[model samples]
Target: MIADSGRSVAFTGHRTYDGTAAESLSAAVERLYGRGFRTFLSGMAVGFDLAAAEAVLTLRAAHPDVRLVAVVPFRGQEERFSPADRVRFLRAVAAADEVEVLAGGYRRGCYAVRNDFLVDRAALVVAWYDGSPGGTRYTLRRALARGREVWNLHPSGGGLAIRPVQPALF
Candidate 1:
């Protein structure tokens, strides 16, 4: 059970990024910790999700109360990952405080389902979206529709500055 949705954050982003994203993301996670967020949810995807999970783990050294929750979309989602990526994926999952696998096998739209699950439980979302249409954008829209605040960590948006994407006025 999530301790507090109000204090929980979900991470979503592109599968690839420049070298600068990791450092900025880490700093963003640390800042969020300072802002009283304790429960962090990761989609367990290859790039940003794994990086976000790792950041949370690193932050635990100084803030042990922080928690990382890995929300996997399916049972063998990591099977397609390269060997090195699989290792990184496993390491993050092993270190997570909680794991929630949404499906026993892969299915169409499982990722959307997983995104919905994360948004349902989080009051905040940290996205590395570049505004292109994709899973990251989908997750961002879902979060915004659910009234969760979003912080875009994409370098194009501005480095390490907590920019909150306000929900649409509609």
Candidate 2:
């Protein structure tokens, strides 16, 4: 079994999130923390990954036990990123309690490797997917297949709404 498989949560979402995403994720982090979840796994991608990690760090200020784990896909993942984006990513990584690099070098499936790694180590997944097929969708499916509780924060009526994924056999 993966480490922290029971006390951990993972995050996934689209890169383009609405303005309400930060608030929505903050509330979700607090709720999960109250439920005894302390370790959070973030894929460390651009959108939801960054937002969720920041939210966790914000919450950690009040709850010292909470941890932020940055699951970087591979070495030099930020090489092609803009300077500002790279700075943001570094800040998140520096603030993380642990940084797990899934691969020593970049490969075709590095992203999938990272996503699966996060899901494998987590019991709950908090996502902000907009129903588009991609890494987020794949991670969500994997999380559900593993019987993980998934809370999807989707935009609705100009705000975010929580939709929990029902556990089902694949």
TM-score per prediction, in order, is 0.90, 0.88
Best by lDDT: 1
Which digits, one per residue and each the tens of the lDDT, describe model 2 over residues 1-170? 23567999999887776445676678888888889899999888877788888899999999999899999999888786678668878999999999998888899999998999988899999888777778988888888788888888664221223364322210
RMSD of 1: 5.0
Which lDDT tens digits does candidate 1 get at residues 62-150? 88899999999999999989898899899999989999999999999999999999999999898887766788877777777777888
TM match of model 1 to true structure:
0.90
lDDT (C-alpha, whole model) for all candidates:
0.84, 0.81
Which pairs of residues collide in candidate 1?
Answer: none
